[model samples]
Target chain A: MRKITAALLITGLVSAGFAAKEEKKENLFEKKLMQDIKVLNEKIENLYKLHVKECAPEYIAKAEAYLDAIDGMSYINPDTGQIERTEISPMDKIIFENKARKYLAIAKEKVYSDADGDGIPCYQEIEQGTNPFEAEKKVSRAETEMKEQKVSEKPEVKKVGYQPLKMHARIHFDFDKYNIKKDYLPYLNVITRYLKAHDNLKIKIVGYTDSIGSKEYNDRLARKRAEAIKKYLIDHGISPDRIEIIGKGKEDYLFDNNTPLNRFTNRRAEFFVMEPTESQ
Target chain B: MRLLTAVIFSIFLTAGSYAETTTTELLDEAQNSIKAAFESGCPTYAPYEYYKAETYYRIAREETSKLNTKAGDAAAIKAIEWALKAMAKRYGEE
Candidate 1:
C-alpha cells in the first residue's frame, strides 16, 4: 500500500512541475521576443569589443527597451488568484512590436543617410521619390565650394587631407575634479563650432586618470570625470551617451609618471574624432 | 501533497531572494570599481576608465541569467543607474 502511495505522489509532483512551466511553453511570441532581446544585446556587445564606441548608445537604448518589455509581460492567473504566464498579454505584445519596429526603422536609416534620421529620413529609390542619401550630394557640393573659397581667399596656408572632420580642443582635468576650470571651458568652444558645422558627427568626451591608487578607486574617479564631460556636452545640446566616458587608471599613460610635469601630461583627457560609420 | 507544494514554493522564493541579493552585491562592487578607476587615473580621465566602466556594466548585465527570475530587470535597472551616476561624475552637471 505504501509503494502505491509513493508512486501516486511522484506522479502528482511531476504534473505540478509541468503546470508551472505550462504558461511559458504556450507563449510562442513571448519566447521569440525574449530571444530577440538577447540577440540584440549580443550584437551590441560584439560591436563594442571591436572599438565601435560611437554606435553604442543606440544599441544600449534598444537593450533597455527589451528588458522593459520582458518585465511588463507578467500575467495573473484568474483561477488561482496568483500570477501565472498565459502566453503574452496583448499589452505586452503591442509594446514589443512597437519597440521592434522602432529599432528596425533605425537599422534601415543606417543604410541610407544619418543615424538620427535628421532632415531627410533615407534616400528613396528614384522610383520611390526623394532619396534621403542623395541629400548628402548637395552637402558635398557645398563643402567643395566652401573649400575653394577659403583657398582663394587665403591663397596660401595650403589645404590638405581628406576634408578634416573639424578639430576641437579636448579639456583635461586634475585628479578627482569635475569643475571646468575657467581656462578649460574656452577650448570647448572649438567643439561647439565643429558640432554647429557638421551637426551630424558626434563627440565622445572620454575621461582618464593616472594609476596611483587601488584599481577600483581610480576607476571611479575616471567615471566622474567622464560624467562631467557628458553632462557638459548635453547642456551644449549633444544627446546623452553620445558623449561617452572612458576612465583609465595609471595603466595607460602617454608620458612617464616619475616627474610631476610628466604625470600632469599623463593626467589629461582628450576628445576623439566621432564621425558616423558608413555602416551607420 | 500540501508539504510538497510548500517545498516547491519555498525553493522558488529562496532562489528569487538569492538572485536579488547577488544583484545588489554585484552593483556595489561595480560602483567601487568605477571609483577606483577614477582615483588611479588621477588628474584627468584616462582611457582605461572607459574600459573599466564598460566591463562593470557588461558584467552586471550578464549576471542576469535565465535563473534570474525577474528576467534580469532588477540587475539591468541597477546597472544603468550606476552607469549614469558614473557618467555624471566623469562628465559635468547638465
Candidate 2:
C-alpha cells in the first residue's frame, strides 16, 4: 500500500512539471508575438509620419488597420510547436503600399501639373468652368487685363435719329444748253462739302424740261442735263455709285410753261439727298 | 418704472435710427462705386469681376430692403470692394 501511494505521488509531480513546461513555452510564444506587434506598430507609425502630407487620412487609417491585422495573425504548428505568420500576406502589403503610392501620385499631380499655369490646378479649373489646357482661354488676370484695354480702346457709337441734309439750292439751267451755269457752282460746292463730310450720303438728280420741243428731243435734253450734273459730282471726288439721275421730260411740271419765268422754273435740275436705309 | 421704460424705448429708437443711417450710407457708396466701374467698361472687360460686384450689390440691396442692417452693411462693403477690383481690372491692373 505504501509503494502504491508513493507511485501515485510521483505521477502527480510529473504531471504538474509537464504542465508548467507547456505554460512556459506558450508564454514565450506570446511574448514573441507581442514584440512583433510592437515592432509592426512602430513601423506603421514611421510610415504614417513620413507620408502624412502626401497620403490622405483615410488611406493612412486603412494602412494602420492592415498592420493591426498582420500583427494579430498567427498560426501554430502542432507538430513542431512553431508559430507561423499567416495574418497579412505579402500581396496585402503590396496592395497597401500601392494604395499609398496612388495617394502620393495624386498629391504630386495637384502640386506640379498646372496645365494652364494660371495658378489654379486642373481639377480646380474644371470646377470653375475654365479651360484647363489653354492658358489664354481661361479667365486669367493677364487675359482680363488685355480685355480691359481692348474695351477702353473702342468706344461704342450710338445711332441717333436719321435726319438727312437737304440741298435747298435749286439748280437752274439755260433754256437750250446742258452745261451747268456759274450760279449753280456755289450749290454744287455746298453739295460737295456735305458729301465729303458724310461719305454715306446718296443723291438723286432729276432733270425737267419746258413744253418747247418734241417729246423725244426734250427727253434727250433732260437726260443731257442730268448727266451733266452727275459728271460734275463725279469729277469733284464723289463716288459715281452714289449718284442716280432721272429725266422727267415735260412730265410732272412744277410750273406752267406758258411764260418765260414759268419756263425757266420748269426747265431745271433738282438735287434730292437720299436718306441712308436702315440696312445701311 | 414708466420713466425707465420710456428711456429704454428712446434708446432703442436712437439705435435703430443710427443703424438705418449707417446701412444707407454703405449702400449709397456701394452703388456709386458699381456705377463708376460699369462706366469704365468693367462689364465687357472684367466680366468676372463685374459679375462678382453686381452680385454683392444685389445682395446688399436685398438685405437693406429686409431691414437687416448689419448684414446689409457687410454686403455693401463687400460690394464696394468687388467693384473697385473690377475697375482695377478694367484699367489693366492685375
Candidate 3:
C-alpha cells in the first residue's frame, strides 16, 4: 500500500511540471499573438536569413522591441473583472505592426542599397556595366603589374673573378725608411676625412717592399711603414681597433724592382676599406 | 677651421643619405596606417586608395633597401596619406 501511494504521488508531481511548461509555451505562441504579429515575424525571420543585423542593427533592435511591446497590451474582462491576454485591442496590434514594418523597410533598404555610393545603385551598375566594381579592377590590374615586376627583378648573379679596390690613395715610402713623408700628409688627410664622415667603417693598410733585401728584414720594414699610417689615423681620432695592417714583404710587386722608379713603386702602402660583408 | 668644417658638412650631405632616425619614425607611422586600413576592410570599399597606399609603401621599401632614407621617408609619408584616405572612404568620411 505504501509503494502504490508513493508511485501515485510521483506521477502527480511529474504531470504538474509538464502542465507548467505547456502553459508557458501556449502563452507565447497563442493564436491571437500569432495572428497579430504574423507578417512582421516572418519578415524578421527573413532578416535573420539574410544576416541583416550588421547592416541596420538599430532598426532591427527597435522592431524587436515593438514585438515585445505587444505582450503588454491587455484589458479587464467586464464579467470577471480580471486582466486577460485575449482582450488586446486591434488598435494596439496595428500600431505595433506599422512601426515594425517601417523599421524593416529601412533595414531592407540599407541592405540592398548602392555599395559605392556613386549615386548609382549596385543593381543598376550591374545592369548597365560589365563590371560592377571598376575601381577594384584597377587594383587587380595593379596587382598583376606588381607580380610582373617581381618576376622581372629576378636575375642571375654575375660573380667577378677579382674584387676592385674600394680605396683612393696609395702612398710611396722612401727607400729603406719606414717613416711617413710629410708630402703624403694631404692624401692621408683625405682618407681620415672620409673615415670621420662614415664612422661605420674600418681601414686596412697593406705595406709592400722591393726584392733588394732579405724576406725577414723587408717584412719588418714593411710592417713599420704600415704602422706609421695606422698611428696617423689614430692621432686623427679614429679608434685603433678599426684599423688593420698587413706586410706583404717583397710580394705582389707593382713593377720590376731593378729600376729605382720600380723599387719606389714597390715600396708602397696601399689602403683598402673593409666592406661590411667581409668585416664580419 | 670653419671653412674646413663647412666643406666636410657639404661632403657629408653629398654622401647620399638622410637622417635615419627621422625616416624610421615616418615609416612606423605609415605601417600603423596600413594596418588600420586593412583591419577596417578599406581594401574592398576603397580599392583605389588602398592600391595607391600599397604602391607608395613598396616605393618606401625599395628606397630603404638602397639606403635612401630621405626618399624612403617621403614615400612612407605618401603611403600614410593614402592609407588614411582609404580608411576615410570606408568610414564615409570622404
Candidate-wise lDDT, in order: 0.51, 0.62, 0.66
lDDT of 3: 0.66
The candidate scoring highest on lDDT is 3
Model 2 lDDT tens row, B1-94: 9999999999999887765336777789989998998888776556556655665566567556766554556556667877898788666452
Off by over 4 Å in 2: A1-168, B1-94
lDDT of 3 by residue, B11-87 (tens): 88877465344666777888889889989877656655765576567656655776755456656776787799888
The 10-residue segment with the lowest total lDDT in model 1 chain A: A122-131
Measured against the true two-chain complex, the DockQ scores of the candidates, in the order shown, are 0.03, 0.01, 0.01
Kindly report which residue stretches of model 3 are placed more than 4 angstroms away from their true locations once superposed.
Answer: A1-165, A278-280, B1-94
Name the candidate, 1 or 3, with the larger lDDT value.
3
Q: lDDT per residue, candidate 3, A253-278, as tens digits?
A: 65555434346667888887654443
DockQ of 3: 0.01
Native contacts retained, all candidates in order: 0.00, 0.00, 0.00
Q: What is the lDDT of residue A237 in candidate 2?
A: 93
Q: Provide the RMSD of all predictions against the true structure, rounded to 1 decimal.
A: 19.1, 34.4, 33.8
Off by over 4 Å in 1: A1-168, B1-94
> Cα lDDT of model 2 overall?
0.62
Clashing pairs in 3: none
Per-candidate clashes, comma-separated = 63, 0, 0
- TM-score against native, each model: 0.30, 0.31, 0.31
